[model samples]
Target: MRDTLDNLYTLDTLATFTPGVFYQFLMTKTQQFRFVKLGERFSSICGLPVAALLHDASLLFNCMTAEQRDELICDILHSSQHLTEFYGCIALTKPDGKQIWLEARSSPEAMPDGDIVWTGFVYDVTAREQALAQLAKSSELSRTILDNMLDSVVSINEQGIVIYANQTALSLFGYQAEELVGKNVSCLMGAHHASQHDQYLQHYANTKEQRIIGSNRVVQAKHKDNSLIPVELRICELDNAHGRSYLGVMRDLSHKLMQQQAIDQLTLQDALTALPNRTALNRRINQCIDNLALNPTQYCLICLDADDFKLINEGYGFEHGDEFLRQCARVLSDFGLYFLARTGEDEFAVLLETSEGRPSLEQQLGLIVQALAKPQQVFGDLISCNFTAGAFCFSTADFTYSDVVRSAELALHYAKSGGKGRIAFYDHRLDQHQRQHALLDQYLRTPDILSQFYLVYQPQYDVAGHLLGFEALMRWRHQEQAIAPDVFIPLAERNGAIFMLGKWLLQQACQFIRQAQKIPALAHCRVSLNISARQFASAHFTDEVLTEIRRSGITHSLLHLELTERLLLENPKDVVAKMQLLNRCGITFSLDDFGTGYSSLAYLKQLPLHELKIDKSFVRDLPVNSSDRSIVSAILLMAGGLDLEVIAEGVETELHRQSLQQLGCRRFQGYLYGQPMRAEHWLQH
Candidate 1:
């Protein structure tokens, strides 16, 4: 009975508490209780014999300190108000130098008398607490990173419904978090993609792919204001414990696109003319050429160069030159049949579309020339200028667009060499001539060819076969070959060699006239020297001519400056004013090549002139063509009314001379009297 009672008390009371804590408490208080009889009594009351239980108090003491064992017993006993009602026992102890958290529950068969309890279980909760702490830390880190991201982050399910959105995502779409939480992703994309959204989704589903996933893609998205906004998007797929989802990181590209457009505009525009520069022009021309290759139609490439443009810039100023270029661009744009581009500082190019198989580029060239002839006002001074243009038509199988441009450029060179403000069409012969002219231009700059130039005097006769005056003409006696005035004069003008040449001719003409004035037979005779348009347009032209007249010690009236009608037409009012000013200083003027220009009679009447010379074309056909006869009669009648003397040029036949004398023309010039001779020979004649 004693053994059984001891066992009952031991089993019942001890099992109600955690075995580790209980045993630890017993080891610390071993002197307080003699174990066998009490344990047997406790076990019998708990319904288990004492021999059935095992107690290792010494080993329990090795696992915990005395203070730990004491604190465990105090908490268990003090927890009677709560733990005692639900659990038979609750224990706490320090094991492995840390707090050991444990709980135990006992069977409900205990009595009020000091009886033992039984049927309790215990568990360690430290591993579970550590796991929960780690999980909470990971969750906080993820939330922090998502909130601070710069790019808008959005998540959607397979149904295209928005499951999650970060702050940036909500702000970018102009929606509040609550407003967008359950909305479809297509709501932000607006109607543009809404109609086709199902198709896109189907495509993706069929291919099991996404175009933007894991890469940057440009796309359009809708804002809260229902405007489409360009955006760069990067999408990624995510698989987690919850489910599969997609993440889209979007960046607005509106400002970036605007900047790119600005850059492109600057790169393609000419800084001076504000037109498409060479880079842009080439690109457009190439594109047009490629298109034409597929269609094979005739096209025209027109190349234009401002004649004597550098002289204007250097003589006037860069500001005035820039104004001139601007006006040129404006006039070219008015043509309205082609696109104009500035190919160089003073060069422009035009591309035109022509009707298939039409060879009517001449009309277009005429229109261009007419347009450029309009007068322009620059820097409080009215100035008129003209351009030389060349055109090539791609009408045959051998010609390409590039060939057309090249040919057009070559033709432009020819037109400039022939005379500026003229149009030349592309021909195979002209190409060879252009190449030779280019070589001549390079070699003709030497001083030998330049200094060897001389003047020949042609005798001018009155109606009674009396010599009036000698007209001075220039000739170049090259070392190897004789260069005609027609050839070398233009080359010299283009190469800027004409200025020096003109000065030399002016001095020689003045000296010769002074010497002729000394001859008793030629006492009243005057000498006429032909002045080029380039020389007349010089800034120092008036001063140089006046100084040469003064140095010759000859009367200014004895020196006559002959200028072509075309020169006066270039800035008519200005030329009239300049000529009138020079005339005031005793210089004389002659309108050379009359009836060849488009100037009105009113314009010609305004010019200060002493003589009008009928052009060679009219005089050459005077004996045959009735129209030429009528034109000559009309011009002589008009000059008679204006009190202007009429000089018939190219009077090569006796009929032309006799007919001109009968028409009341006082002056006659040409080989009929005598061809141009050396200055010494003219003195003897």
Candidate 2:
């Protein structure tokens, strides 16, 4: 201990000694340092210039790091009895150069004058430090493995504190390495998960539950700002020399979720209007029915369709029809309907919530009808919606959802059959209407209905009371009632039964001419048969007529085919050619209902027409209705210019006949001339 205290001498005592040519400085019997080594390497490593050290060796003593110098003193002062030696490593810098480690030793040097100085030995250990650095660079592969991983890599010690985090983990949680290291790993979890994380670790430590060790899990992770995000998590047990720790990998799922949502939108939406498609609407119906168990929500399923939409589709191409539907979707969307969809080619459906305080279902339907009344201008064509809607209301009482929708469909058919352009609510009476359609379908398919079909003729006469011919009118006498010609005729046309009925009518007309040929009074008279537009357009029409003529052996001149002006105007070139072909073979065509159709004089001269029959509507009110007089005068003058023979029908009074005669109509047919009668009754007359 005396030697140790003697080696720690002050700078003043070292100054009193003579400066030595040998590499040595002195120290007193105190723990104060003064460099005695004057070698260039020792002076440089001790961080003092050669001149500064020579001028005052204490400069080298002050240049030593505080930690290294204090450690040296502590080692000397705490030594055992009689031990003054000390040896250890210390670090220092020369000027602003790099740190250089030193292996230094000092011992007491007792002089004869009772002053003492330390004999110090110091050397540079920079090579040893560099070898340690090279050892660390050799393990760089481990760092590269962690950095290149897509999943975030995190390591937590047995105490649940984070000890290591890779670049991916730093980026995933939005934190720097220093900010995350040493913090509890639970900081990376949501609050709910964080609360239980400690318990999880404790249980795993005690019970060794390996539930999370090797399995992947979907979980939420907290970012640095505490916002939670979804992540796919995987954890593995890591056992190493330091202690127990955990390594976790996490992958983000935000972009994947966004892509799935985009795909779902495309699947469930209409391509044009972005409305829910038929599939989604079907799902929505079931969902609404499920909600009915809780609330008393009154709902209605409505079926609506455009009237005469086929006409529009044919008039303007289908592309325009598609644009019309898209526009209709826009209009219906603005109604705030509970649901809407384009359910058919030109039909739509809407689900409405008829809750209390809202408008009644009827009123809501009326509002839509009124809105449809406004013309929809599309592609410079002003088109009115002209829609017919049918609704079936339902509450919780309805058991099956599909049945209610079917009931609405039945109501829609009833609305259209009752003369469309109206809304019809589902009532019990519509059940009877459905039955009747079924019955009609059965009747049309059966062969027995043909026997009940027959024709009656209404005679045509000139003003002089001479018989010209008779118009053949077909009628159906049903088992229960006499069905109106207007009702049964459209039914036959709609069901494709018109073609058969038309052929039968022509045969009967030709048979009548054959029978009437037996009587001299009816031999040369003509027979006018009204032809349906469907039948007139048939390719077998001219053949049917000539075949009937040869079968009955009646002159083809006696059979006159009556067709409407509108039918003549449709495909005028075709109709004209067909009429001219038959007209050349002694068959004549009479233009039926002349003024009521497309009555332009441009097509008047083009048709091979033998007569023009003024519509009965104009003939009903004759002389007193001067408007009818003016209309009749115009028709007569146009017919005169075109050399078309004009005949007036519905002549119920002598005044009508006289008035028609004054308008230059020489032929007339109505009850005034003769009521429709059997060919036998006509022959007897």
lDDT of 2 by residue, 152-248 (tens): 7787888889988778889989999999999999999988889999899999999998979877688999999988889877776766567677777
Top model number, lDDT: 2
TM-score per candidate, in order?
Answer: 0.47, 0.56
Look at candidate 1 and tell me the lDDT of residue 139: 24
In model 2, what lDDT does residue 329 have? 83
Error of 2 at 486 (Å): 1.9
Deviation in Å, model 2, residue 642 alpha carbon: 2.5
How does model 1 fare in lDDT? 0.69
- How many residue pairs clash in model 1? 21
lDDT for 206 (candidate 2):
99
Cα lDDT for residue 404, candidate 1: 62
Cα deviation of 263, candidate 2, in Å? 8.8
Q: Per-residue lDDT tens digits of candidate 1, residues 128-226?
A: 233224333442214345555555667777677788777877778898888897888887775867767667766776897766567767788888878
Model 2 misplaced regions, further than 4 Å: 1-268, 282-298, 306-324, 355-388, 394-396, 399-403, 410-431, 621-630, 653-664
